[model samples]
Target: MNRFKKFMIFGALSVTLLSGLAACGKSEAEEKKSSKNADGTYEETITIDVFDGLANYMGVQEGWFAKIVKDKFNMELNIIAPNVAGNGETLYQTRTAAGDLGDLIIVDKGQQYNELVQAGLLYDMTKYYPGMKNMARFDEAVQKMNEGTDALYGFPTSVSSIPATSPSEGLEPTFGAYLRWDLYGTQNYPKVDTLEDLLPVIKSMQDENPTNESGKKIYGFSLFSDWDGNMLNAGKQLTTYYGYDESGFVLAKADGSDYQSILDSDSEYIRALKFYFEAKQMGLVDPESTTQNYDTLYAKFQDGQVLFSWWPWLGQAAFNTQTNLNAGKGYMMVPIEDQKIFSYGAEVYGGKQFIGIGSNAEDPERLADFIDWLYSPEGVLANSSQTSGSSGPEGLTWEMKDGEPVLTDFGKKALLDGDANMPSEYGGGTYKDGVSALNINTVLPIDENPENGFSYSYTLWESYQRDNTNPVLEDWSSHMDGAVTTMEYLEKNNQLLVAPGASYVAPEDSAEISTLRNQVKSTIVEYSWKMIFSKDNSEFETLLNEMQKTADGLGYQTVLEFDMENAKAQNEQRVAVSK
Candidate 1:
């Protein structure tokens, strides 16, 4: 699977794994459960085995960062994570079904979440509602979680209620369409209002500059099947062009119609697919995109083989100052007409990551308090950066200056190394591949902070300076002229970032619906490649028909009617909760 896909499956579990809780049954689970502390602190250590290697990186038993978590909360956290990455579906399916789930539960959205809900694996969050510290303030996320049920079951992470952009900030477009600005500038900046317009522009750039500095051939675009979970791939993923789908199920509202399968000929997803087919014909789409995993795909980005990116962060390693600032190499494109969503998030619960107290958690109150702590200003700051101010390792990693958190050069060096001073137990590089949000801390709010927007989040909380470099986007933006960052563009267009149609659907499990949904997913995954890599438009057309036929036979229409019914019902809840 691709890195993105792998993350979607394992990231949540990696953060929520409880080797401790998983070992216990109902009897043992109660014994280990924590009790509420009168002083809002615990005197014992809490073990979290989210990491495969167990959180050995920090000698949390004695590490300065550990000391901070302990000192602040009066509790010690023993974190654990994997030393490598892998798909976690089997592990979860086996453990959750066995009723030895864990002390905490964190999972991504999809059929799995629904299954867990149906299986009664989740803790009903009704009793805690709107009362967990700053949680009520994150209303969108709260409402999103409230969907499909009268009670909330999970909390989302990495959400920003306000724009998280700043002067010269890197454009983190939620829509996967992005381009290398350096090449676009070389062609004198053409006006591109449609997907077709992006064609020759990328072609000319690839033709003009055939290879990168590393002697690798450069291509106009790249795709990955790894992120194609549930049998999805680039073709259907482009449905983010419409908005996030709970399943790969798509609905296009632009043509004065209700939600329907994106597999339809007129769907924006198909149009984007056709665009790729044509781009492939021009030798502009990277062939490796089909074969490479995320690590390899990311290496290509760093190597400069891929000129454009579907996701914003995928292109970051190649985004040094020389290219982005000196040569003006990259920028996000404005949303297209058929493309309507500003962002595809869990809205609150299921977009990126989610958290819930384990059904077997020993102390539900303690876990709730712990979760509440995570939403506080202090917890947000800690999860954001490696270590800072009182949360980090003092002179060794960070220091306070005039009450402001700063990463010292020495500390930056350790952080960049990732395993520096990671107590002997940490034993290897800090828990697996370099992906954001998977940490010793389970189900954390990586995007939380005590700041306003980019102005606050960027300058202080989200600064890029590990030690030497600082504000990659800020520096690059200084050299940029009249650049329209993602936030600016969205506001200018009066776009609304709303919950996806699926999110509005009831969370209740429907066996028939799920069966049909998986069948549709399989069809899309199998045939999307055939259509995109077709030798001719006729072949693409032929493949499209085959997919539609398979979908229809599989009861795709009935699924849609069911979806519409549920969506209308859920939409009412969505509107009511949003208010």
Candidate 2:
């Protein structure tokens, strides 16, 4: 259920320590006791303020996943949503300002983490759940880092429950361009080494399949305005080709902590914008790219009307849609020239959601224990095995076949083919958590899951066959007579890097530059889109000049100065640590 949304690499995270508030935690004798009625059933309700796509509870109230939670904790989830999104940013800010944030809360890392901690709105789990010390998926160090200077408050969620130190052996370009698989195959899978080089392939394919059998128009490349949240838009993915997280004011090469405004004719963003410009001139730009939201764009892709995806996950589901069944295909993660997947692992979190209990909760201890349990192997198993629907559904939600944890056929169907709206059908809270954020947003580690079982690996499920006893890594080996998958391409090229995304520059250093930073980023993106779409090269050049002038006039250089200082410090730390 955890997945990338725009920029979020969804997965649950691990544990930390908070000794000062330790008494609120259970005594040794209390650990054996469950907070249940004498009948051993949870009869209460706990409210949660959720964010983004997980707000759907239309039929999730009957989901079995929800039932498991009630059966274990004697309580049920009461889901809440903000009037607006950005992971409940407005709601959280408003609630924190008022000094209450429901019984439970889930927010993205960074800004929200700082806000809640600075406001003293979250409970310190160490005081209430000393038991976190032994959690199977616990991460004392990450928890400590997130805790900052205060007692640990937020529980890191939506991150790997267990850590894998080894580099990934696949070419899953979390960031980069993706093309509809069948189209690329038809073109003989030509190498696309740069953004400009990709233009012709898309145009050629669009020419061949200009319209679907239904006659809907297909575009060569499309963009989404929604992904431009907080300044950077989809173009940030282009920065990934250079192995850096796009901070707008700062840029680095190969994940080197050398920050500063590196935007130039040769910079990643400039190159990406120029590529878009060329695509536009060549009649390959989607008019919708400037007007549509991701939902609209995805709908087009779902119908196979989309020819190229700037972000890999944006078009993932579309490839598997029933409409694309005969035409059903996936996107090949084609690399741009010289681009390599940054070597990623524990240091770089794909993305994470942190969880926490409200400070005003009647009993923080129970909530803390519930979280600790979620991170434990047992908790992760229960939380993760929500028989499939959406994403990959080829494994058991949870089951034992001949002493091996295995996925059942029915379970796989429930995930892939089952109804998204199950609450109306199942009734009685059986599907209450089905298709909701709660289904994901908890801790679990896929790498640690065993073979011949229901692991969280999508590659395994998508390629899983009844004849294969060992499931997880076999997809690549089984394909095309031992031919590597897209992931294997990057692994073979060693493009992966340890760029855990520029946490090198601490938050405070950039706090003063927030306004200027936003101004510069907004201006760049504004012009980037315009320049790309401009009818004349002269007009495009004019906009580019204006964009730079506006940034310089707004003291963008001062912003870069601070970034440079912190980046040097961060790189120093990186060097020292490596040595």
Candidate 3:
């Protein structure tokens, strides 16, 4: 059947299935059962409306993990997933507005979770915490923050702990400033330790050789103006390097209290803009960068017309499919500045697409039981691995070996061994070729020590096997120690700023807040662009002042006040907890 018909059929079946479950009233025994399971371990059946992104991988329809759930926990499973077109976010908004929310809804975005909580659409999981002791193992700060006003709306999935290192100990973290190994030979490539080091390399590439086989000039780098690529790669990340902190109500501050909005006349801000403009003028950046989307940029990178660009490692894998550019030839995650990387911490719980129980659930206890079961060791394995027999249209599936959910042999071999010669899982259907040539060239050396003990464990368990341990682990204890020291220093000095409350605003305010934020951000973008393209830096001050004025007119101060209030409230709670 066509995809549309299939989706309709799936949707109807899911609705019917859920309705049937809802009709089955929760028995007293089930409530007692759920309560017991909540405390320790128990099992119950629950239906979940998940997005295709997750369902396609887990093989939910084929019931690959159902037998495990039934045998282990005595639970039945009902899954509702979109088969085509829309993503988790879109489907969630639609269902929420229609009041057709399922017993469990998996929300992916922080903003969305905040809005749902604010709207009272989600159950306060905090109330049930007495039954959920497993949650206690999570970070304390994260648990407290997610329980906004005593109502815990979601569970956090990814949270990185503070590293121990001085800010000045290593190179500054940077974005999109990597040397393209496929285009530039490793021998001639300069050891780029920082943004400053990249200047000479760009000049050499532009001045020395311009065109390749097709007569298209080879640019030193590709600059993207698209929001997803540009904001993530340069705007947000590179801006952070220049001391633009995102924590709590402040944007860019010269002193702790003196907020010199980045959209305004800040010297550091001006310098950053000037750098980009110079790169553009020197023809080091793609001229079409501002206009090109990711696909276009990917195509350019794949064709080897662009030598360097800022993008995720995943993107590199996706586009460079050709044998020459594939595997070891095309990509290398060259760290910018050789500095200790500090990734921005996303929201704790509500940040993930969650599976929330709806008020309409006939057996809330049963539903909660099912969700709890999903969190069990077996459930986590089933969801994460591709051992399940069914492979969805997305060409994604989970595999199980010896009852443990492991990546398909194809996936395991590719990532672990870096076997370029072995075709990817997408190429062959269930082909098991042992002794595939392992490509060891792509694996980077990792620091191994007590500080990185957890990371080391994860790498060993998931990525590397005991039999093949060529990449010897390095001593990263000092680095970890330094990172911890740095964090302690910042916290002691009250310099570990929190992200602005505006960052976690609900989606309900998106239209208005986004418009306001865009206006302010665009001013920064314009001034930065102008500074780069301008022959003189004289206009920088005037441009920044005008941008600030525009921002102030667009409720910048109001937003700042709101964020400050939220931060104050948060701090008060922290103080209370201390007592």
Total backbone collisions for each predicted model: 22, 39, 38
lDDT of 3 by residue, 1-579 (tens): 000001111111123333433333222322332333534444444444433223322223323334445444454444444423334335645565554455555444355455555445566554465655434434353364465556555554322222212121111122234445533343364566765566677677556657765787778766554332111234444444333433222443212233433343444344456566667667686767667755576667656676665433323433333344323444433434433333223222212234555544545555555555444333332332211111111112224345333445444344333332333433332322211111010001111212223221123233233322221111111222332222343334343333311113222333555455545555556655555555544664566566567768977766555545544444343233223
Higher-ranked by TM-score: 1 or 3: 1
Reference-based lDDT, each prediction: 0.52, 0.54, 0.40
| Candidate 3 whole-model C-alpha lDDT, 0 to 1 | 0.40
Candidate 2 local lDDT, 108-189, one digit each (tens)? 5565565556555666565555556434344653555454454666665544433333432222445556777677667776
Q: Would you give me the overall lDDT of model 2?
A: 0.54
Indicate the TM-score of model 1: 0.71
Residue 383 in model 2: shift from native, Å?
A: 4.4
Candidate 3 vs. true structure, TM-score:
0.56
Model 2 lDDT, residue 400, Cα: 56
When 1 and 2 are scored with TM-score, the better candidate is 2
**What TM-score, over all chains together, does every model reach?**
0.71, 0.78, 0.56
